[model samples]
Target chain A: MLFDNTDFDYEISFLKIPGSDFNKEIRDSKFLSPEEGFLRGNLMKDEYVPYKNLTYFKLTPQNEQETLLLKLMAYSFTINDLNLYLDLNPKDQQTYELFKKYVKEKNRLEEMYSEKYGPMTITETQGSNYNWIMDPWPWDNTGGSMYV
Target chain B: MFKYVKHLNYPINIKKKDLKMAKYLLTQFGGANGELAASLRYFSQKFSMPDEKGKSLLNDIATEELGHCEMICTMVHQLTENATIEELKAAGLGSMYTEHGKGIYPSDSFGNPFTVTYFAVTGDVLADLSEDMAAEQKARATYENLINMTDDQDVIGILLFLRQREIVHFNRFKELYDYYKKKGY
Candidate 1:
C-alpha cells in the first residue's frame, strides 16, 4: 500500500544518501566554502538523532556550524564504540588512543552546547542490574533515534 | 595435533500425522529446485571444497535445512490436529487421511509420499552451492505464497519469520560463494 504509484517520487526521496547512486549529482558537486563542506558532510553522514520537535533546541545546535560539529563528534563516538566492541583486533594503538581523546572532546562539546539549551537525556531508564533506557533501536525509527 | 570438536543435534522431530504439510512442503523439496535435494547436494560437495571456510559454510547450511524440515513437520501437525476422518477426506487428503487419519507423514502436497530420490549428494562444490542458492529462493517464495493463502495470524507470522530466515541464509551462502570464487576454488 505504501508503494502506490502516486507517492513514488516522495518515497524515492526518502532513500537518497551520499553513497547511493541516486545522489550522484550532489556527490560530484564541490562545496562552496569550508562551512558548507562541513555542514554537507554532517548531513550526508546523518550521525545525529534529530529532535522530536523542530522547535525543541535542547542539546541541539541553533545554527549550521554548531550542527556540523555536533554531528562530527557523534560520528566519532560511533566509530570509537564499534572499534572498541566489535573490531577483531586493535591494529593501531593510536586509534584507540584517539577514541579516548575524542570522548573528552565530545563531552565538552555536549556540555557547552547544552548550556545555551536544555540538556538532552540520552538514556531513559536505569535498572539495578540491567539498563534498558537506551536510544531507540535501528528498526524502531531509523535515523530519528540516537546514532549509537 | 587434534582439533576440538563440537557435536550439535536438531532439537525437533516429525510425527506421522505431520506428513500432510510436509508432503506439501517437500513437493519442491527435492526436484531440481527442492530443499532436500539442495541440502544433500551441499553436504556431499564438502569433500571437494578446497578451503576450510567453504567446507564449513556448506556443511553448516545443509545441517540447518534438516532442522527446517522438522519445522515444516511441526507446522503440519499443528494445522491438522483433531480433524475427523470424514472431514480430512472431504478436504482432499483422502490418500493420507485414509491410512493415517491425520497422522503426521512426509509426502508431496498431492500425497505422493516421500522417497529417497528426493535428495542428491553431488560432490561438486560449485554445482552444490548453485543449487543451494536456487533452493533458498524457491523456499522463500513458497513461504511467501503460503502466507498469503492462510488467514491464520499465527501461521502467517511463522511463515514470515521463516521467509526472513531463508533470505538471511541465502545472503550468507552468497558471501561464501564470493569468498570461494575470490580464492579460486
Candidate 2:
C-alpha cells in the first residue's frame, strides 16, 4: 500500500525529530540511565513522545536499584523491537549496532540486578539452591522479587 | 528456551472480581483461539519452518504470546482472588474452584485443558505461514469478543493491547508469506 499511490518522492529520508536530526544524534547521546529513565524505552530517544506514554503502571518507591531494574527492562524492549526491525532490514548497520549495544547493556544490568536481588533468570542463580521460583512470579502487582 | 521478562508486556491491574466476566475471560486464557494455543502453535510450528527468518519470527511472536497468556492469567486470578467456595459455587465456578482452587489452570472457560488439537505444525512453508495469519485473525476476533462482553476499563485496556498485538503479528506473518511467494518457494 505504501507504493500504491504512485506519488513516490524517492527521497532518502531517515527517521527524524522535528527540530533536530533525532536518529543521527541518538546514536551517541542516548543512554539507559537513572535521570534519562528506562521507563520510556527507545520511543523517547528516537521520537519526542508526548506526556501520554505507553507505560500504564507506576512503580512504587523509585530508588537507584529499582531504576536499574527498569533500565534493564527498557533495554530489553529496545532490543526486542530492534530485532523485529532487523528481521526485515537485516543490513541496516545502524540499527544492528544499536541492537548489539542494548543487548550488552541489558545483560550487564540483568547481572547486576540478579546479584543484588534474586536471579532474574535460571542462569543468574549463583548458589546451589534453585532460586528462580522464590517469589513474585510476574503476577504480584506490588512485589519486587520477580523481575525478569 | 526463553527467559521471563519479569513484567507483563502491558500492565494489567483489574480491580473488579466479577466471576461471570471471569468465565468469559477464561476463554481467552486457554480457549481454542487463546494465548496459550497461539504460543504453542508458533513454537511448535517453527521447527518445520524452512528458513531462519520464519523460525526466529515465530519464536519471538510465540514468546510474546506467552506474556499475553500471563497477563490473561493475572486478570483471571485477580477476578477470582477474593471469591469464596460458596461464592464461586454460586458463580458457576464451583467445578473450576474444586479443581484448581483459586490457581490458574491452562483451560478454557468451560474448563477444557489446552490441547494440540487447537493448532498444527505442518512442514510446508506457505501452509504454515498461512495458518499463522489465520491464527492471528482468529485470536483478534476472540479478544474483540471478550472486549465487547466486558465493562471493566482495565480488562478492556489489556484486551485492546492484546488485540492490537494480534494484528501486528498477522501483518508480520503476511509479510513473510509474501516474501516466500515472491521467491517462488
Candidate 3:
C-alpha cells in the first residue's frame, strides 16, 4: 500500500504539475515518447519465476520468444500508462495518437503471439479449453520453467 | 469481479539485491501511506461517494493501487530473496526474517505489519475525496524518496512510473472534487 497516506512532498507538488501550463504542455506534447520508458518489466533481472521454484533454469539471455514477449509487454504496458494519463489530459492529441498507434501494434503482436505460442489474454485463446495458462507465466520473462 | 493478470504493472527486475532498499520500500507496500492501504481505502470509499464520477475515481484509483502493491511486493521479494541471514540482519530485515523468513509480508520496512488504522472511511463524500487527494501526494513523496535512495536504474525507472500515477490520480481526484463542489455537493 505504499501510497494511501497524506504525503508531505505530494502536498507541496500536488496541483503544481498538472495545473502548471509548462508542465502540462510538456506532458501532452509528442516530445515525450513513452514507448520504452515506464513499461512493465521485472526488476528481478535473471531470478525468480513467481510461484514455482526455478526447476534450476539459470538466467539466460532472452531467447527469441522472450525478446518478442518483452516487446509485447512493453507495448501493452505503454497503453496502460498512457491510458491513465489521457484520462486527465483528454485534449492531448499527440498522446491520443500515440495511444492509438500502440493499440494497433499491441493488438497485432498479441494476435501473432497467440497464434504462434498461446493466448496472452483470455480472448486470445482459440480453443474452448481455457488452455491459455499452458504458456509461460507473464512474470517469467526468461521463459524458464520452474521445474527446470 | 477483477480478472487476475499474471504480471506486475510496472515490472521489478532488480539486478542487484538490497534488503535495505527493500525494507524502505516495504513502507509503501504495507506502511500507512503504502499501496495496499490506498487500494483498500479508495475501494471502500466508493460505496459512500455521492456522484458517479467520484465513485468511479475511487474505484479506478483503488484498483490501480492493487497493481502497485504487486510491484512493491516484487521489489521486496527480489530484494531479500537471495540475502543470507547475516545480510538480512545488516539490512535491518532481521526481525522481519524472524517473522516471515524472507517471504514478502505486508508490513512497513520497519517490520510493522499492516493495519487498517492508517485510514478513515468516514462515508462523507467531500471528506473522503479530500483525503484521497492527499493520499496521492503522500504516495508521490514516498516514490521520490525511493528514487533518491536507490542507484539502480531499473528500480528508479519503476519508481518514476509509480510516482507519475500518483500525480495523475491526484489530478483526477481534484477534478472530481471540483465537479462535486460546483454541483453544490
Candidate 4:
C-alpha cells in the first residue's frame, strides 16, 4: 500500500449540469465527462476535433493513487476548458454555474488528494512537513506514469 | 503571478526511452510553431489588445500555453532520461549532448535555438489574433507530423491531445478575431 489512509472513495461522476434544458445556449453546448474531457483535451464536445479520426486510448489507473491523480487531472482539465469558454462567453449563466460546481468539486478533490498523496501545489501543504520536494516530480517517469 | 502546480495538465508517463523520438519532439518545445513561441506571442500581445475580451482571451491563452510549454519540456525530459552518450550520438543528438547534455534546451529539431523571431506580436488586435490562429494551425500540423513519426502509443496519445488543444485554441482565436471585427476594433 502506498499509504495507510487509502480508503477514500473515488467512484463519483462529474460535470453534468442539472436542469440543463432551461438554457438554450447551454443546451447547444455539449459537455463530456471529466474523464473524456481530459482525454479529448476539450470539455466542449463541439470544440474537440480528433486528429486523423484516431481516438485516444482510454487510461486505466493501476492503483488508488493513480485513480485519485487521474480524477484530479480530469477535473482540472474540465475547469480549464470551461475557463477559456467563459472568458469568451462570459454571459452564459448556466455555463458559469456549471463552472462553479466543477471548481468547488475540484477544490474538494485537491484537499482530499493532498492529504493522501502530498501537496500538488505549495498551498496544499499542511502542518510542519514540507513535502513539496518529494520524489517523482512531474518530469520523473514514475511521477506522471499514471496516464500511460 | 503564476502559482506553481506540481502536476501536468495532462498526465504523461512514457515508459519507453526513445532518443530519436525525443529529438523530433523538440520541435514542439522550441520549433518555429512551438508552444514556447505561442506562449510568448500571446503574452506579449495581450497588453496591446483593445478591450477586455481581447486582453482576457490573450492573457488566458498565454497562461495556458505556458502549461503546454511545461508539458513539452516534461515530455522531452522523460524521453531523454537514462540515455547513454553513444545512444545520444546514434540518435543525432550528439550536439545536443555536447551543449545541454540531456538537459531540456529550447531548440528546434534542427538544433536552432528558440528565438522570438519565430512569432510576431502586432499591436493591431485583428493582426495579432490572425497570427495566433495561424500559430495554432501550424502547431496542429507539427503535432500531426510528430504523431506520424512515433509508433509509441504513449507518445501518440499526448500528441493527439495536444493537437486537439491546438484546434480549440485556433477556434478561440478565430472567435476573438471575428468579435473584434464586428465591433470595428
On lDDT, the candidate that comes out on top is 4
Instruction: Write the residue-wise lDDT of candidate 2 on B59-149 in tens digits.
Output: 8888878877888888888788888888899989999888888888888878998788988877888998998899988987887778778
How accurate locally, in lDDT, is each candidate? Answer: 0.45, 0.68, 0.66, 0.82
The alpha-carbon lDDT assigned to residue A57 of candidate 3 equals 11
TM-score for chain B in model 3: 0.96
lDDT of 1 by residue, B55-111 (tens): 666666666555455455545654566566675666667777667665655555665
Q: RMSDs, each prediction? A: 15.7, 8.0, 11.2, 5.8
Tell me the lDDT of model 4 at A7. Answer: 29
Cα shift from native, residue B38, model 4 (Å): 0.4
lDDT string for model 3 (B1-185, tens) is 77765445644466688778989999999998899999999989989888555665677678778988887887777667778999988877778888888678898867889999989999877888898899988987888878778777656766766776776677678878887788887
* TM-score: model 2 vs. ground truth: 0.74
- Residue ranges of candidate 3 with Cα displaced over 4 Å: A1-71, A78-105, A126-148
Q: Let me know the TM-score candidate 4 reaches against the reference structure.
A: 0.91
lDDT tens readout by residue for model 4, B51-141: 8878888898898899999889888888899899999999999999999987899999999999999988779888888899999999999
Error of 2 at A143 (Å): 1.1
| Model 4: per-residue Cα lDDT over A1-148, one tens digit each | 1111122122322333355542344335587666666877776766766666576656777777787788788888888888888889999998899899889988988898889878888888664688888877777787654443
What candidate 4 keeps of the native contacts, as a fraction, is 0.75
TM-score of 1: 0.48
**TM of each candidate vs. truth:** 0.48, 0.74, 0.72, 0.91
User: Which model, 2 or 3, shows the larger TM-score?
Assistant: 2
- Model 3 lDDT vs. the true structure? 0.66
Q: List the TM values for chain B, per candidate.
A: 0.76, 0.96, 0.96, 0.98
Instruction: Report per-candidate TM-score of chain A alone.
Output: 0.33, 0.60, 0.54, 0.76
lDDT of 2 by residue, A6-118 (tens): 23121322111256554345546543221122222223243322211222223332576656665565566566656765776688887687678678877888888877777
